[model samples]
Target: MKMTDLILKYLSIKTEVKIPGFGIFQQKNVPAFYDERLAALLPPAKEFFFTEDFNLKDENFIQFVAKEKNIDINESYAEIAELVNYWKFTLQNKIVLEIPDLGTFYFNDEGNFIFKGKHFSTESPENFGLEELNLSELKNRKSALGKSLENEYKTSRNPFWWLLLIIPVTAIIYLGTQNPELIFGKKSFKNLKKTKTDSVVKSRNLLKDSTKIDSTKSKIPTPKLK
Candidate 1:
């Protein structure tokens, strides 16, 4: 079996697979994710993390490989050692090591191993047939709600025009209640009644004068016609 296949085999039944003088591979379960900018929901997934561990020893890995290849323990150990050394040497020389169907492994500036694997998928089998949702309409609704709230806030802060009208009227009511004579003088109703009566009499006199003028004009016969 290939070195990558052995690593996958170890990871299948065990939580962690460590290759002596190389790195450790482990499966980690990740929770569901929400991308606000994309307005998408991503399902839970399984991801692999690789950590360089040079001092790890796995007797079970050796036994499994020896049994699988039908080789003795010594021969299996030697073969495993050769492959691990090759990978380590290549990584030290700053060359990328790619495992087929697994991932590419490289060393960063911090000398830490970074793995980019093809086997890592965000789609979960448990979430089969599920697709990402587009929340564009919900975003529009939220924007409209924000604008409406802003308008309400502005309206609340601004003074009402009717409030200005109420001030003078309120003052009039208060003054009239305190001292009646201030707003309406003595005999206020009588004076108002007299004013209205005077206005009516004046209108009647004007009407009577217009009638007399018309009668006078009619009594004056037109100069005798030739």
Candidate 2:
């Protein structure tokens, strides 16, 4: 049978059986036999319990099975090894594996493996299970919050900024009102008007001087006209 089929068959078993070095397959409430004499002889036997050691290296057995069944193992060995590694890590702290209807595999904290019946469920709580949160929703919420915060910051600074702007304007107005000449003095627009008026006055004076000169020449009359 295919390894998958074998696993399925093993899973279907209701009783717990040991897969030798791998682990033990069993159901709950099975008879627990104790050897008092043996326990007494070996003090350490008191804590001794049956456990499996299912490691990635155990894929060799699967390969053997594949060869025996004349099935193409091909890349499946590595695949199976990877799968076992995933299970080992994922079920690190768990003591038992509950394969529905197949059986349960148990592993001690120290990495010893054991198998048991499938009737029991060793699933973790809902909260403990893997969670799938919407990262997009979180990103969008953060973006919106960021925009709102930016707007709030601008709004908070607006009053101070306006005050800063108004201060300069007010100072200018005050200075203009206190000393209009300082802004519109002779050096500014009024200076140009005054310059034009001075030019016109000078031209008029020149004209008057020229007219006086002409009258003096006329009064001098040509002395040669006997």
Candidate 3:
């Protein structure tokens, strides 16, 4: 039997058509949008919406469809990937893709690629008796919270930065004190040693002069001996 015939046979409520890894198809009733202005322009939107639950692991089903249609599955997959990538890169670029049995997929003015038959409002809010949502305050609050989180992250990383800075500075100070000539270049160490020797000699001379004054005071005669 043809693939479509097989699919149709298994699509009954009791059979619960399962596309391998994809989820089961279950019928659901969707509510219609009640708008007087839209009702005047077009027929009342359909009350039901048919949506598919995609399966990432449905490669076999995809291959079966490709074989049944006499198409190269790999080439088709690549083409689809390219189309999706292009759409993502050029968000403003609009294109229409029509699958054989499925409906057309086209980008609308709002940059959304909605299914052709989906219900959407084209009229202004006044026509629908609706008011614009006041989301400015909520948006501002979220923005403030984001800023607070950014500041907190900066503060948390501050200590690691201080450690990175201090370690290099400490290492330089240690190396400079240990080998002054390495930093100042040639003869700096010799000059430092000579300065220390001169200071020591000057201190010894001052001590000797104080001792001579004490000896002279001891040598003076008493009054009775004179």
Candidate 4:
């Protein structure tokens, strides 16, 4: 069988297929998640990924190939080596190479090999009829969270409404100080208030007399004081 066919067959049954001096092809599970846009749960699925481990030697792979093909072990090793060398050469010269039913490989800017299509999961009997889940509880939770956030935002945007409670108290205190009679009635005070009022009136009268004298002196005299 061709190298690609053998690899595809091995990976169909086995979770990992190691290529000596190259890399390992292994299946991985994509984690499940809640999709807010769809309001559904996405089921986990299998995917393939490559790990380049040069130090790994897969004696079992060669043995399996040799036994399956009924070929000599030395011949199997030589064939595998030739295939690996061809792939490497193709990647280096053409910058990209595709393996049938396995994945695509290409060289990046640093000349490092990059693998794509590993996430293209194969359809297996296990996931043949899988379905996504629609969860009402999750939808309710999201709705509640949205409402809570909106309420918090509104409170923060117009927080000064709470301060309005103090406005009435402040106005009352100001009015009481400026016009105590409004709240306390006209007879609330008598002796001390009258004395203070008399002192203010006397000071105003003295200020008016002094201002009149200064104004008369500052004016120019008429030809004859009429």
Candidate 5:
């Protein structure tokens, strides 16, 4: 297409383009890095730079232009030389020179020839589009993890569990400190109450037989003389 467009394409392909009397255009490599805000990995990229030294055309670059323009190499070289002179004349007389989609060439306050690329986008074709991290989903996962931990703590504990073992132990200790016969002997408080009731019944029966004293005396069992 246009000569300026061809210059840009050459920069993309060869990574450098040197124009007589203007400056040399070059591309810089920006390596991939992690982007914290997006929480994603960014791809390697290309950036532009310019210098005033070695403003000479490359043989392969000239050949590329010749092939693209469907012209001979000598014709291509002459056209490129004329374009370079036009760029230099514009910058020297008009105080600025603009190359469409490439950059603007001008003298800075330091009287240095400088190039600033137009529409300087850092987007690289090597990138596979990645979505940004969702903060809401991250917070939800954190809350769920906290709830899981709480449930696990609750499941591992029984509030009244100590009572199950303590009650039996306390009862055993109290019984040990008291009379052994309460738990192991037949003549305990239950046996004493039964004995008292039996004695009272025997006395009542004796009173009922007071008029039959001789019958009662004969009924009593006695041991014979040894």
Candidate 6:
């Protein structure tokens, strides 16, 4: 990866990233504020600035690069130094030094430094999904005591939602265990067992009645033959 890309990426999430002999990149957060004319609350935004008054390398920033590239600190230091020298050499030759996502850095004829930054949007898709909050809609809202997140959860979540998940899970478990009758309710299981028991007892009684009839017939037939 190019050094400029690495530096721009580092500046994206960090408050300050300083490279030796290069410069310092800093980020400032502009808080959300109300727009009186629009009657809406503007979202918070980010601002970036560059400074070149210092000549010291930031070890923490170098370490971040080291970790990101999965390299040792020595390699990281060498890479940063090479990039810094390239930027300086480019500027010294009166060539336009452009860093993508940031802006351009160039020296004027009078030995003065100038940084021209591109404007970044603070709107939807890039604004972390924040919307322009309209306060007029809140005029009729009643103030409540609980937290908004808590209230939202209480309203949006169903108290019996767990039952829906639990029922299917329990059925799967019972069926996996080869006991589907347990899933049908204890009363149904008991009735099924009782029906099997009644059928067996009726079969035994019928067998006994047939045996008694057979013995009586045998006793009467022997007398007839005599």
Q: Which candidate achieves the best TM-score against the true structure?
A: 1
Better of 2 and 3 by TM-score: 2
108-149 per-residue lDDT for model 6 (tens digits): 788776886543446545468666678876653433434666
Tens-place lDDT digits, model 3, residues 1-226:
4443434334422223444322333223323343453432332222212233444234544464466566798854554345445534543456564423323456777777654333432244323544323355567889999999999889778988889889999988887999876676767244444468878899999899999989998896768863
Using lDDT, give the best candidate's number: 4
lDDT of 3: 0.51
How many steric clashes between backbone atoms does each model show? 0, 13, 0, 0, 0, 0
**Decoy 2 TM-score against native:** 0.27
List per-prediction Cα lDDT, in the order shown.
0.77, 0.53, 0.51, 0.79, 0.72, 0.74
After superposition, candidate 4 runs with Cα above 4 Å error: 32-43, 109-111, 119-226
Query: Could you tell me the lDDT of residue 83 within candidate 5?
Result: 85
Superposition TM-score, candidate 5 onto the true structure: 0.45
Candidate 5: tens digits of C-alpha lDDT, residues 1-226: 8888888888877878776545677887655655565555545555677787544545776788899999999998888888877777776674787777777777878776678754333555654443334556678899999999998788657666667778998887788669655556655345344458888899999987885887777796778998
Candidate 3 at residue 113, lDDT? Answer: 64
lDDT per residue, candidate 4, 122-168, as tens digits? 46556665667789776888999999999998987685965786798
Would you give me the overall lDDT of model 1? 0.77
The total of clashing pairs for model 1 equals 0
Error of 4 at 29 (Å): 2.1
For candidate 1, write residues 1-226 as lDDT tens digits. 7867977877768877767667677887765676685676656666677877788887777788889889999998898899989888887787899877667888788886678654344455775645555678678889999999999889776778568778999999998999888898766355343368888999999999999999998895668878
Model 4: lowest-lDDT 10 consecutive positions: 117-126
Winner on lDDT (1 vs 4): 4
Q: Give the candidate order by descending lDDT.
A: 4, 1, 6, 5, 2, 3
Off by over 4 Å in 3: 1-28, 40-57, 92-226
